[model samples]
Target: MGSLVYREELEEDKNSAFTWEVQANNKAYNRQFKQKAFLCWWRKKYKRNAIHTAKYNVFSFLPLNLYEQFHRMSNLYFLLIIVLQGIPEISTLPWFTLFAPLVCLLTIRATRDLVDDIGRHRSDRAINNRPCQILVGKSFLWRKWKNLCVGDLVCLHKDSIVPADLVLLASTEPSSLCYVETADIDGETNLKFRQAPTITHHELTNIRKMASFQGKVVCEEPNSRMHHFVGCLEWEGKKYPLDSGNILLRGCRIRNTDTCYGMVIYAGFDTKIMKNCGKIHLKRTKLDHLMNRLVVLVSFPKSLLWLRFNPWPGIFLMLQMWPKKSY
Candidate 1:
């Protein structure tokens, strides 16, 4: 037991020494990147030079917007009739008159969606504009959230939103306890607590003291499960098991501490937030289903009824022949 105690103390001393050295190295690295950030500012005058590339554009953007409208069965049925307007016989004055009103209504709806989509783009800009901490020597420097990358060390301040999925290392709490609010993502208001790796959680919490902290994290690739991370933090020849308990997810707001130090493990779309929200699917209501059925049934018999028989009387007779619902 005495030998084991002696060995533990020796390892702690070695880790502390290494932390200082890492701090020195970090300061040098920060100085080098400072010049590059300024030079690129001239190229991107409005947005940050490091902004994440968007997947949407004017050409593809319009088509995708129209595609959402196309997903509705009602819209499809209405468009099918309008398309037949190409035929001279089908292009009657009454049918053309009805087409105008329908086109106006659809135009109004598309405009509303365009406005809503603009709002989403603005929100995305706000999120990416938020500041993220990048470790520099014994201190942390703030940078745009879009500049954050995997394996970077970041400091989360109280009430600040997390910019990426990171592995907690140390916190203001002596026992390495960190609290975060996840209401934005999970819809829960209560704060949740996260712990740092057991092996090095106690080494240091002060930014200066932990400066030399050089650690290697081995974790599983990004996955859909929010609370199923697996990994280990290796520091100073010792390994600490890492799991969901040690992860601070992006978009979660930090709480109840001056700051907590963490290492970035995932960023951008690879974060759990994006994984959970797979795609935007337009929902179809019961009305849409009915419209689709009506389109199919009417199209096949339109020639027989409209050309030979009286359309109104034939439609009425068919309605009467069908079973009536009793409330």
Candidate 2:
């Protein structure tokens, strides 16, 4: 019996090492494939003719350098508006009045800059590019130091930002599994089990499991709630219960496991996860642009109307339209 146990242990160690080697080779191949594809695409898109067209085209609003510099200066323009508003007497000066249109132009530019900034930050956070702390094993540290890959096994603790979506591989003995707050994906506040597959889809179209964290988490402050929904998959087979250390996809809720390893089938922009993120970003950008246009359309005519009826007409209109409910 002792001999059998020793042989089994040796076999398990060999298997584990073999799996790790396979994973490493796969990662390297994928990295090279992606790099080559990117270079090919870049060369095709930025050929000599493309550069010339972009430069001399009347529709080209500005050169890339000027556009970037203008964007960086947008915040300063916004600050100038606030300063100008505080001093009403300055508006009466001849020079100030003459330059008021220039100031208005600057304000518009600043507003655009503000919107762009919000969009960029949102995109960065959605894709997990921003700096945040995560648990690798015994230590709690920021992800800035370690370069995480898609298929790598990760250990997450309570309150740590999940570096990437992962599957629960193993839990601490005695079932002391860390509770994960998945409010970013699910709308409910309750903690979910990180154990085996409880839910399975029947349709092959729904067999491909996907977990997305792009949606907004709407909950109260502090332990704020997150919003998550079931993902669609396309597989055909009877749903079997997964073991404790079974593979899980990114964005999965690992309930009872302290450590988990997900086979990184998808990573970067090619993954369904990144596609969903891109969709959310596009939606937010469109909404923000529409709101800004609406505000300007409403305000522009009002300002012009005020200018048209200034002096005597302005005083009479103000007196007649003044509210009498000053109590």
Candidate 3:
């Protein structure tokens, strides 16, 4: 059996006329209403996360500030001991009374430091709530629509993250518009020029026309095998025909222009693009966490050791001074 070709299918179905009025009206309405609602939802989420972060920041400072003040006072008390040590006659009277204030200062400082540590823990929780998913290793990925089918071409536009890998059927002149950044796929710092009518077998086999692949990361590794397959992508059970000059910007990909499309070879979690991106990010996050823990472990013991040894001389001198008897 001959493999089904998209252009052949469309040519065979010549009786089906393409209607622009309904699609245009629907797209306009969606762009206005649906997109507005999505933006509002995003704003609300950002505000909520900000509030949580603010609360955490406020609480985190309490311990550090309180203990800092206490530590200052302790230093002052230590200074007083040195001053008292200078006058031999004053040391004869019940000099132990002078040590009381220093002891109190040290105690307060220690307690405040403990409280600050607790506050820091709370702050960390708040920070974690904010989306800090930095794309590491190579790229980041997300599934666009779950219900997409074989030979379906889709359109996507600006500020959209790509849902799947696709071929470039049509795109604006790269020099005329801003350069496209594909750091997630390309793993490079510079933006790449987007030339039209480029073909990659993985995503746009059905889209034979000139188009741009928007919203997906450009794969960086030259040696890695790109997965090419035709399957159903989940989206409200409606199958949109993959056509020429149509834009497909589902999931994280966005189309800058209205008149572009590419065949959907894969969608959802199974897309090779998403899986690779996710794996890169996961490994990066784990490494970051491990480094943080290692830093804490290395520094903490050294700090404790410093505190133990340095403070002893002054404390020893205070203990040795003989108290004068009252006449």
Candidate 4:
């Protein structure tokens, strides 16, 4: 019985032969990397970088920012009109003269916003439509990046922004050494170097080898933390421990290598980039609120002046003190 137990322990050690562990005790349970585990983890945590789909449609007259402009400018214009309209001197003048400049500003702002929305739509369409290589049953096939699924093996090359978070498998560089530019995502200008597993370094030597590749990679659960990765690549009864050195995040540019191959670990919005972004809400500054209060405070003295002096002359005097909306 003791001999049998020792044999089982030795076999377990043989299968779990890994070089480094990123986390001391948080390593995945001792199980072979499986397709089901990859799919289950991806479906549970993955998200795509997507703008608000409900907003900026061609049918809508107002772009996303138009409402914000209205809140900033139109609201102030109406408040001023309400206070000044009751003045007898201003009421005698053309009412359109009071609002014409404000109307023009609003029109110009809306036009600029619409153009920006159109540009955004064009960019989104282009990215979603761009093609990448995927292994399709012993041959490589071109597939759109947007439709990429977890566990899909992708072929990457120089100067292209990676579309999804991936595990390094093989690269064209000797010893599977690759470098990438992460300036687009984390604002790092330096080219960061990455490595494929030393064990699987020679597996993809040519197009035929890459096209015929198949493997399962098990990694840490998807997380919002940038610059942290814990996982492993496994194939043919071997497990290779992986860290940030063996990972390529989405939005990073491949550089200093002709081509590389990776397995998509997380796709869509569940990626690190999308997960780390804060909520889509604006935070007004202290100065903004102070300026709004200043307008109302200044309005009080103007109204008092009209009450103190004759209403007609005081009305015109008060108009000169009016401050325009900041936005």
Candidate 5:
């Protein structure tokens, strides 16, 4: 037991020493929406809670779809054939023959992608518009999840999903302890416990006291370390150390405790869960690889035929089409 105690003390000392040289980042508080004009600007200071899972929007659909489609060598080959057909001097077939089919193919794919992305847009809207209670002045008012900002206090009820990363404060439970379920975050069904800072748990007992309390939290920058946190809450000229046990991460569900109050530390894209959300990437199937190889094989022979039969005429016509030198 003595040896274990000494080892724990040594580890704590080393951690303290390593962090002692780090500078503090104090978060700004904005309780009232009176600064309404700057609200957008303030939210921008921290990442907005709005999520965009869709790949394309109205303005980008055409160009982006075309770009993705042309990534296939077959599409490029068809396009080259269409261009060749357009040149009357070298044309062996009507351009519309290739043009119509290529248009249909691109249109079908684009329509499919557009339909899928519309569903994503609807999902994003539904989630961003979900209502939560945010502290404004001394009272809590219902607001959308996307409207939440860093340093804002939130009141959560049992079974409610946490909208952002927050530091647990006073709760209805004894000793200000809060119970939460992280099934949405880590696929765990068991309840986890989060405790409020002793100073805050005791002093901020009521809504009025909570509104009056002006505390600054200094912590590490937003990160994906879900089970790790390092910070200190400064209030009334004293700082209380905080850790993961003192936090209620986004996507967690409040359980057992009837009500709990927490201050948002990370919102929207800055939350640990959001940090872990990897970007959506395009996945090509084995069929796509085989088709590309076949297209290359077919195109090589066509190119050789064109060069052997009509290369000189095509080159001469292209040169004639080019603008004469100014000289």
Candidate 6:
């Protein structure tokens, strides 16, 4: 049994193989868009370009919402009361009375959460479906943001939104410089310029050259470092150093450059902005916590009343039935 378990563990380890290094347009590791995942066991699996921020969906709404709502002390207390009311000996009221109110309260809260999450879903859809020009072969063609993959070459025009984190390759501006506005990313309206390496700027000057370009980038894993980037671009048997100034981040807006080309380094949630967005968690305000405490406090007296009144008749009968003792 131990040997079998070890063999299974080794198999699992082999299936989870992934790396931080990304190779541009290399079919050996960079799986093409629209390809299935099951066929790519030996290759590294990268994150998709689609992002989901919604907390619940059609299949998960009821169960997930109930699970989240019951995390509150008040809801659990109410549920306890409803369960107690189901017992004829302990209950002073019908179970349905408390059950109905709980159902209503849960419905109201769930509806509110559902509406908010629906808005998030719509926003995600809009962003993911936004159009951009991607290099299909030797020519660029329009595609949705979600269609982008790591190692894909992309073209950005002036006033365009960047779909993913990309390395600046070449641009129409002198010296392959590209300007961008990071208003959506940092809330700063200041324009920042990124430049391509001297080798790429001179060599990959046209669409045909960019299509045939194959460069491997060795870099650190995705992180929330917005102003820092460190990597090296390897191409044509030479390596060029890269930094933050050579990279264009997702959520940046192209500005003051007519045409610029880039190769995607990070897509989807791996992008720095999305990494900084972080995961959504259940947050309760002070007032919410106070309300929960208040519910418990308010219900305590009712429980005390039940304890005081319940079985009192039996106690009186027992008192009357006690045997008289000679004093």
Largest TM-score belongs to which candidate? 6
Which parts of model 1 have CA positions greater than 4 angstroms off? Answer: 1-56, 72-84, 89-91, 94-99, 204-212, 301-327
Residue 178 shift from truth in candidate 6, angstroms:
0.6
TM-score of model number 5: 0.81
Question: Model 6 — TM-score against the truth?
Answer: 0.82
lDDT of 2 by residue, 1-327 (tens): 999999996665444321211121133443432223454562211011000101212233235423533343333443455555555443334455535765577567646755665565555445454343333433334654125554333445444445443333334423323455455554556875544233321111110122211111111111111122122211233323333233333344445444432323233343323334433211235655566566566666776887787666657656765678766
Model 5 pairs in collision: none
Where is model 4 more than 4 Å wrong at Cα?
1-45, 48-55, 59-66, 77-100, 186-189, 202-221, 234-239, 274-290, 300-327
The sequence of per-residue lDDT tens digits that candidate 5 reaches over residues 219-289 is: 77676768978888877788789899999999999999999999887778878998898676665789988
What's the lDDT of the predicted structure labeled candidate 6?
Answer: 0.87
TM-score, every prediction: 0.69, 0.38, 0.25, 0.62, 0.81, 0.82
Q: Superposing all C-alpha atoms, what RMSD in Å does each candidate have to the true structure?
A: 13.8, 19.5, 18.0, 12.5, 6.6, 9.9
Q: Evaluate model 3: give its lDDT.
A: 0.38
Q: Regarding TM-score, does 4 or 5 come out ahead?
A: 5
Per-residue C-alpha lDDT of model 1 across residues 165-282, encoded as one tens digit per residue: 8888888786889999999988999989998876667666567766776666655656567876666666778767778898999789988978788877666766777778676556
Where's the lowest-lDDT run of ten residues in candidate 2? 45-54
Q: How high is the lDDT of residue 304 in model 5?
A: 90
Q: lDDT: which candidate is best? A: 6
| Backbone clash total, candidate 3 | 43
Indicate the residue-level lDDT of 175 in model 6: 98
**How do all the candidates rank in terms of TM-score, highest first?**
6, 5, 1, 4, 2, 3
Better of 3 and 5 by TM-score: 5
TM-score for model 1? 0.69
